[model samples]
Target: MLEVKNLAVNYRGVTAVEDVSFRSLPGQIVGVIGPNGAGKSTMVKAILGLVPSTSGVVKFRDRALKQQLNSVAYVPQRSQIDWDYPITVWNVVLMARTVHTGWFREPSRSSQEIVKDALVRVGMLELRSRQIGELSGGQQQRVFLARALAQQAELLFFDEPFVGVDKKTEAIIFEVFEELKSQGKILLVITHDLGTALTKCDQLLLLNKQIIADGSMKEVMTADNIQRAYGDSIFIFNREVV
Candidate 1:
């Protein structure tokens, strides 16, 4: 399980996230949704220790999350990646094995096989030799997904995974998410998509800097909750949000 308590983050004396707390169990997909500048990404970064938190505690399986970094997989936003980097898709996914294989040592046969399998799962095996910068947006996203899979982590974080991807890639990612859920992996995804994909999550964390709502889709998508978080945005709820 994952637990976050009173997490907060500040950037250059400005508060980015405040009093964020949530718990997630295995075999569940939690969607973090909010409007722009809501600090959804910042909250995730704070939880992962990628950014310093002003105050908070992050625990996984009763221990501090930093102590179990090897069991965590993080796929940052595509914008954060340098697509111009001259690296092949295969090498990108294979990098995940470095945590276990050691940076200076060669990857073992099993590690190689794991990387291959991950690529195959994401349907990026054939593009393994291609440069990451040469692939389409969807294909590049799949490569990152493959890398995350190769890690075999218990907990995974994805930031705006469906952004700039084709429908096929979206389907592939959803399939992989279901597979990971079946394997008892915990997934926390930050997504702006609020259509069919939004309904797929077992829980939703609706935020506007701080958490406005955190519960099942039905609970978090209430009319008042949506209005509070999105603030008069043009959205038509399929169900009675009331």
Candidate 2:
């Protein structure tokens, strides 16, 4: 449902992503795996139009990204967000519906229902009335996810969704991903956890400033691929290929 071709992103002459290309089909979880500074996040930002690309084309369902903005949702790294903002969970989630509801119109009954359902899906329904700053880190992450879910996007992008959460919360987030996939939504998750990427994602993009490998987990998570993505400086202890 999403396609990126010959994509290159630059910041003041330093290339973040170079000639990157990939496609994501519906009902699939695609993991973009890389070490620090591998440009995984840059690639995602380019696709989402958060940053202007130096070159390349991003298409969603055969339409250019400009025309398909509503079809995709992005959950940025929690660290990038200012959780200290004084806003309720309900307000955060309701923002997602603004695109459909328009700037001047208030959220309709149907949109409100979708927002509530999204909060419930993310296990944040009870916290909906609570202030965002009052919640724990995991709860805050769930609020962001709920906002994205409320968008009802056909394609979703998550950047390091499991960074600092407990195992239980991580599992809950993965379960939410499964539910989204079951509903035929495409997911592209940029993650640093190799184990979770291998276990949870159907497809993998092993990158280190370039595309090292892209395919099914069995095909792309080989020892050689891991070595290339991580380089000789790092090691995975007791790693067993599934």
Candidate 3:
């Protein structure tokens, strides 16, 4: 389980995320949804210790996540990655085990097998030697998913995974989400997609800098909640938010 208490973030004296708190349990996928400038990305960054947090704590198993960074897996928005990095799919997935394999020591056969399984699970095994830059948008996304799976972390974070991907990629991602949940892994995803995909999450965290609502799909996605988080610009009637 993951517990975030009074989490807040400030950048250059300006508050991006303020008084945000939530708890995510295993066997569930939590969606973070909000309008632009809602601090969705900032909040994820803070919890991962990629950015500074002015207040609060992020804990897993009642221990701060900062103390167990290796147990976490993060796949940031695609734009954050340089596709031109000239690295192969196999190398990227293998890097996930570097901490466990040791920087100077060679990877054990078991670790190699784990990575191969991850790639095969994502249907990218045949292209394991291809450079990420050479793959299509959907293929690139699958590569990252394979890398995260290789990590075998208890808690996973994915930011805008469906962006710029084909329908097949989107389906695979959600399928992987269910697979992870069944294994008792926690998943927190940040997505702006307001279509039916929004209904796939076990829970939704609506934000406008502060948490607007956090509950089951039916609870958090009410007409009032959508209007409150996105304003009148986005109307929600008859449960059709988009």
Which candidate leads in lDDT? 1
lDDT of 3 by residue, 1-242 (tens): 89999999999999999999999888889999999899999999999999999998999999999999898999988888998998999999999999688777798899899999999988999999999999998898898999899999999999989888888889899899899989999999999987756778888999999999999878888888888988898744455443
Winner on TM-score between 1 and 2 is 1
Choose 1 or 2, whichever is better by lDDT. 1
- lDDT (CA) for every model shown? 0.93, 0.87, 0.90
For candidate 1, lDDT tens digit of each residue in 28-52?
9999999989999899999999999
For candidate 2, write residues 125-181 as lDDT tens digits.
998899998999888888888988999889899999888888878988899899999
Clashing pairs in 3: none
Which segments of candidate 3 are over 4 A away from where they belong?
236-242
How would you order the candidates by lDDT, starting with the best? 1, 3, 2
Model 1: CA > 4 A from native: 236-242
C-alpha RMSD for every candidate: 1.2, 1.4, 1.5
Give the 10-residue window scoring lowest on summed lDDT in candidate 3: 233-242
